[model samples]
Target: MNFTVVNKNICVDNIRMGDCSSASIFLVGDAETISLSAAFDTPPESLIVGPFVPLASP
Candidate 1:
């Protein structure tokens, strides 16, 4: 999954991670894309994000 700020000048803050045994998260502000790689035997729960304006992925 991916997320970004509505305005390019603005950025998402207060990031937190949870509900997964192991995963790699890559955040690219220049391209405005957050990539996630999850490793688990079963489906993992959703990630949590703090209150912030969300922008559509390019």
Candidate 2:
């Protein structure tokens, strides 16, 4: 199922996520997991996890 909590887009937080006041996005892929916490870390932004992050978006 695709869902979102503090994120704007679709995702599935496998567990009950903590207070996502920070936009620390943890992206998990097949071979690796990349975090966008640098750009999206800490408060008021949003939490987003997905397949790919476009260069434009990053």
Best prediction by lDDT: 1
Model 1, 1-58: lDDT tens per residue? 6665574565677766543332334454655445656465654455555575444333
Query: CA lDDT of each candidate?
Result: 0.51, 0.48
lDDT of 2: 0.48
The number of clashing residue pairs in model 1 is 0
Off by over 4 Å in 1: 1-7, 19-23, 31-58
- In model 2, the runs with Cα more than 4 Å from the true position are 1-14, 27-58
Instruction: Write down the worst ten-residue block by lDDT for model 2.
Output: 28-37
TM-scores for all candidates: the values are 0.25, 0.20
